[model samples]
Target chain A: MGEIVLSACGLSKKYGLSYALDDVSIEIERGQIFGLVGKNGAGKTTLMRVVCGQSTLFSGSVGLFGHSGKRGLAEARTRVGFMIEAPAFYPKLSARENLKIYCMKRGLPVSENLDGLLASVGLPGVGGKRYSEFSLGMKERLGLALAILGDPELLVLDEPTNGLDPIGISQVRELILRLNRERGVTVLISSHILKELSSVATHFGFIHNGRLIEQLSSKELHARCSDALSLTVDDVEKACAVLENICGCRNYKIFPHNTIRCYDGAVRPELLNRELNENGVGVSSLMREGKDLEAYFIGLLKEGRANAQLY
Target chain B: MLNYIKADLYRIMTRPTFYIWPLLLAALPAAMIAGAGGMYPAGVILAAIPALVYAAFCLMALILTEHTFREDMQLGLYKNDMAGGASRSAVYIAKLITGILLLALLWAVCSLSCIVSASYWLGGDSGLSLLKDMASLQAASLFLRVNVFLAVFQAISIVFKKTSALILVYIAISAAMAYAMKWLGAAWPGLAGFIKHIAGFGAYGNFGAAAGAPHAAGGVALLLAPAACIIVLAAIGSMMFEKKEF
Candidate 1:
């Protein structure tokens, strides 16, 4: 409902004969951190590149901040900051010097608050160190520093916490959250670390073999993955009536083969089971079912692979 | 484009190689003058100055192009530039212009040394006059040759992304092309003349006598060849660069 910060529609990018991105469409609204979930070579980076204008598309369009077309997208991209793959800088130049180059290229005053920006990324006084001499964690921190240099409205970061230590990872996670909460910056981030992503992402798009298999918000994904009291009953109609009328259960879903799942209504499993059985809706089986984000993504990939084979 | 240019200037000027290369270039005249040791005519050394300067300029161009482009390609900095909203043509042209400006600085240092040496050895009035004459005679041709070499090499660097491969392939092609032109010239005289004129070799060979009585038609054609080559080569280079994916 908020202004769309990034909208990529029907994006397809082909390398040789295979598709790096196949008919992918994604949109991120203002202040949303959309995590691109996929294994390696699953089109996450390619999709990010296409959105950032680093890679040309075979068939599709990208609109940023409601701006489309060549000239418009170009002008729109200036408002976006991106760090794709490795953080690239002159190896000989210090982190501060590299950030200054970015400032100059973006036409900002060379005197922009670079030290403050570096400090914000947890790279406070190390700005004078050469990039070549940086640890991978430091490099990633500087990359973050560069991405936030111009106070961009949108940040397209690919694996921003890639080489960080555990504390560094938490720092980056906190930084992303703070940026989103404070400055309202829209982020399109991709990472192999799904758990880390789950902690920060407001929404997610699971990509598999160059196709986006699913897109859901954090709330929706939680609802799908949340613990559920599942029951297999003899009569589906009777079971639904008994659950609704007697047990005071309001949130539940009925599946095939007379199976039912109750979620989010505080319906105790043993009590519901006995109530259903007592109400003449023979309860055949009862158990709890749930999944974490990783399990859900793996299961989605498998399902997608099977469907691709079927097609 | 101006932003990129400014940034590139700041980067190159900060590096010590920018100053070192031109100083080496300026020292060429002194080195050659010491080696000549009063054996050859002063005019011969002066005439030979452009040739020595051209060779040094070529090396400088090669190093400059490698410094300007190859490092970026290897490190993937171009991705940062293009993603930051700089047009591809702007990045390419900005680099080319930076290389030219750096080359111009080298040219100025070398020219000043050549003039200073010429004045010291040949006396004031006559040395100044002769230096002025030779500069006018050689300026356009030398500038075009260096520009064409830089532009062509840059185009090659863009098209061929690998640094070692670019160097090996460029050297092989240059050697092969030189021999091919030589053999073709042996077979056909007019073609040889045309090749010589276009390649600027004839201008260098005839710099002394040709200064006062330049053939207007031939001179125009000579300038046009390299000038047109630069424009066409730059156009093709920029086009390829624009379509290149990070």
Candidate 2:
């Protein structure tokens, strides 16, 4: 909706022949939080690492704030604030002191505005209390506090709600929303929690086998991951032939008892049954399958796995 | 660069290891003095050994570097380190400076111990004049030189991300350099003088010489040589680490 703050073009990273990230491309607009969702080993962390310069690039490039050179990565990174993987902090330092350390290192104008910063993350009265004493959720909140130091323009968090309790997740969610809506900072968050991500993400990017399957707004994902009907028959080959030739319902799958989740919900079940019966192909049952994000993710990954075995 | 340096310092200051090392070094000469009671003159000289021990302590203290970088790298601290106005060069330099400061503090303790103890025992009637002697001055310079050498060695350990290997390398510098120099002397003439000179001894009985008479070697070069070595090693380390991906 606002400026395109992060533009990744042909961004790819490979380990040996297997690509960790394969020619992935995406654009993140300013003032809008972009959620990057993928399964384990799907390259979300790898991509985040490359963008922030903790990891290297095998090919292609990422343009952050319009600066695009190997040497320029350091300069461009100044505008981006992030908490990577599981966040770490000075275990001995108090929350207020940690902020001071962060701010002092950035050479930003030193402020005793520690209270406001801590309060933003709901960590009031955290002064003089060492980080080791904080709970996992409290530590995560403090990590968020450090990330927001000096009011960075774009905040990148990898599983910021990781290991946090329900209440803690809600706190992080609220904080992210406030930072984006109230503070006007763009954010890029990567997580495997589908439903949780689905709630706060204005946009989504589906990464399958280190490749971009789809990069759409939450509205589009919701539309795509919507409910559908699946039919399971006896022989998948026969089911495919019957569905393709007789019913002309081609968009589907032939696995786990010849299942087909029909995207075209308007298909007539009676007609389909009649054709399959007339064709001598046995039909066991028919049921509706909603857009299960987890199932879709597994399907995409399996497809990739199958493709890999071919080579 | 300033920001990163400050941050590195902040990180170091907050580390338990950081405080422990400095405080130990600061309090060591006094502690030994109190502990030895009547051990007298040798107690002070033994204090010098501890000062040198601190230098070794610094060279071997790769865990500080490892812990800082590992926590950051593992927890993704470098990403934010850069985002907080620190470039790669700044990060590298900050660690470098921090390492040197720790080494310097270690050396200062040793030198201060030498000054105090030598003032008590050797400085009698000679007053502080014994400290001004060419031999003591030479020994002080050698100690400073060792500090720089160890600092550079520690810097390498930080960049390479290996602790045991660097520790071995540091021990070699501390224990074997002099022997290696002696061996080199018997083996060759030009190499002999070079080894003896860099080894910080022309005479075994000389100030820096270990409890015996010594030979003759470079004088002005003695002062300039360690400085040159530090600059060159620092450059090599800085260049390697500046653009290195965390």
Candidate 3:
């Protein structure tokens, strides 16, 4: 992994009687596309806001580019870009005019690489059109262009693809990939589209009820999601011995209640059942199961809920 | 800070309303002079200077309230400025400076128009001396009074972040205070006299005094009183803005 671009520790925020964020801690490394997944009101937006210095008054510390505290965070934020909730723009101004204002405010030379910036976001011919006339997707694209105005090292996007069409979605996905691969910009994105995120995210953090339930790399997630053959049998020691010695199958896990799960999908379930039966292992049930990212997320949330019930 | 000011200036200047409002205000003095049969005594025009100057200041305050403070906050321009790495205090100061500069521009246009109209129609150099004296005093007093209004409005804008509500509250409270002071002065002269000295607008009390006598000391106090209020109010406003979330 590269250097840690953002690290939030023990973040706790409350509004009135309820806590929006409850001791949430997260870290994003350079060049990584970290996906934050959570249900509505699960503190994903709150956490992102705090990290980007939008919402303050939280009880914790945030380190951006290895800098912490008010002064440090303000300095570090110069190198960070973000689009939170909805895009903000002057309704009366044209796209070019609005960008000109933004560039001037950022202390960049106005009109410097402006056309290219607009073109990069697929807004080449629409510079003269007022921002209020643009559609939702177009507004989102402009927002993205504004966020990347200074070529920020870190991009914090909240539901960037929310208002995009299918083609726009794919374009944004490719854009994110190209930015990460070519510019090495670290991205922190939150979305409800699991399949879309699964294709791009390098790491995943699942949040439930204002708490981070799980965090894992894409490789680890995939490894945990591999297809498995679940088997119920008597004499679990003999079943394991038969599977390893007789069938030459070593990738399997034994559970309580004399159950075993074999992870080698290449080996047929029938072959394993036959081998276990011929080895005098009494098999009660056998089933093949596979999980995708969405199913895995659901399973994790369920497990989190079950654990919560216990406490 | 310069970058923020530049951006704000661009935004303010591009709108037609910015130029249109000032032109309209400049026309008022010409219109008044024209309505008086295109000729009046120098004393009549000189006596009207204070009222016209006050009108200009009021218009400037309305513009600042509507254009700079309220519109920026409503459109999330302040957030955009902060997002671009501008310190909150810098943004606040930039807005103040930009508003003052624009108002000053408007004041110049209106004052020049009035002077030109008087010179063209009234046709007298005797009243010119008194006009010049009152004009300078009114200009100085107007600057201080406008700064006070802008500082107060800017502070309110930072705290409330809502333009329409703030303006409504400000106008309502100002009217109420004026009426209350008038009533108090009529009911108990001594009490009102004491209260007027410490009021926020107390600094401008010397405006009339300076107009009559044109004293250097009163003029200096006129400038310093608002300057002091601006510093204290701007500091408090800046601290509030710095701590504001979003």
Candidate 4:
């Protein structure tokens, strides 16, 4: 509702035999953390490149914030800061110097910008510290700082935390959240870490085979993945017999050891246990269960692949 | 665009390669003086005759500019910069400024050397007056023209995305033009008269033909011709770059 910051109309990029992106379309609302999830070679990077104008869109159109003309693309680019792949910098220059050069390149007001930008990324006091000396985590932070140099309204980060350690990854995750929540900046991010992605994304675009398999909000996904009742009993055989006899136990799964996962979305645990106890089965534990994103995602992917094979 | 141009000049001027070129060029005239010291006062007039000797020197600046282009692209710096609102023309002009700066550095070195080498001669300049000599002025002017020419060559070098090919083609064209100009100069004597005069290539012919009427004209003509071609070539290259898929 705030306004679409990025909208691609039939965006397609083909590399001869392989359709890198086939008629891909998505709209990103301003100030939203938009997640682009795809398998390897699913056109995530290619879509990003086309949107960034790094590579021209081979088919269809891209309009950035109501500005799609050449001048519009040019102006929109200034407002978009991207770290496409590995951060590029002069190996000889320090992180600060690289930022300074980037500032100069963009003609941004840089009186105190470099210091503030560096500190914002947790790279403080990196005055004469040459960029070559910085660790991968540090480099990724510096690259983020550079992307944020102009205080762009939108950030396009392609695997920002790709190769970072757990700590580094969390730090980047926090930084991204702060950028979006605190700064009110729209973000389009692509990564392999689905759990981390789900934590931040307000909307998701799941792509496969150069096409968007699905696009849904968190509430929508949560609702669609059938909820279940989970139970942990001391005697799995007893719970299985009790469940099989119950009216709603036909679809339940007896997990390894002493757990039975019930797929009946509306069945309450108290009622289920009371019915089981009345049937001469004692229960130790019972709780309602819901499908996790990973499970739901796998189901969707399998469904998509099955459909593709059919066609 | 102006900011990008300024930033590019700053980057080029600070580079060690930029300073190295002019110093190498400055040594050329001095070497000329050292080879034929006191043998001919006329040699003073003929001292800097082999202008094309430093063509290779200018080629070095072209190489550096091409290298900068390659580095910017490789470093993803170009991606970052272009991601901003900077125009492709701005980048092309930046290359021109870099080439000019390198040429300026060469001029400074040559001016210094011409003064020192001329000093050991009977009619050499002394102190601050060394740079004021007419031959030093000529060398400075030629160096300026060379920078402009190099800017164009460097810009075109990137258009083809290869430095060696453009440099080779550049040298081949220069040689071909020289030969063709001479052959044409004999037939109508005025066939390409306007082009040659515009180029000023015939102003100051090499010293062995130092006093020939064509030499002085060739020197002045060389002043503008290549530079003009460079400017035109740079413009074309800029358009190509803006439209080409980088």
DockQ per candidate: 0.71, 0.36, 0.59, 0.54
Candidate 2 residue pairs in clash (backbone atoms < 3 Å): B202-B215, B203-B214, B204-B212, B204-B213, B204-B214, B205-B212, B205-B213
What's the count of clashing pairs in each model shown? 0, 7, 0, 25
> lDDT by residue for model 2 over B33-106, one digit each (tens)?
44554665653454354344434444434545554444454444565675554556567656656655655555
Best by TM-score: 1
User: What DockQ number belongs to candidate 3?
Assistant: 0.59
Residue B199 error for model 1, in Å? 4.2
Docking class of 2: acceptable
The candidate 1 chain A region of ten consecutive residues with least summed lDDT is: A264-273
lDDT of 4 by residue, A142-178 (tens): 8888888888899998888866889778877888899
Candidate 1's TM-score on the B chain: 0.85
Candidate that beats the other on lDDT, 2 or 3, i.e. the better one: 3
lDDT of 3 by residue, A1-311 (tens): 67999998989988877988999888989999999988899998988888876677558888999998778888888898888788889998999999998888887888588878888888888999999999999999999998889999999888999899998899889988999999999999988888898899999999877888889999998878877989999899999998888777899999999989888867688888899888899999998766877899899988887987999
For all candidates in order, the CA lDDT equals 0.82, 0.68, 0.79, 0.71
Q: Which docking band does candidate 3 fall into?
A: medium
**DockQ, cand. 2:** 0.36
Better of 3 and 4 by lDDT: 3
Candidate 4: give the TM-score of chain A.
0.88
Better of 3 and 4 by DockQ: 3
Model 3, position A63, has a per-residue lDDT of: 94
Q: For residues B1-246, what per-residue lDDT tens digits would candidate 4 score against the true structure?
A: 667666666666666665665666667667766676656654454444345444554555566666456567545566666666566677766756655654555555665666666676535443234444335424444554455556556655555555577767777776787788988888868756655543434443233333243533556554555567667767887876676444
List candidate 1 stretches off by more than 4 Å: A229-289, A309-311, B161-164, B179-192, B199-206, B209-222
Model 1 Cα lDDT, one tens digit per residue, B82-185: 78887888888888888888888778888787677667765565368646754663466667777777887798987687767877876787777678778988
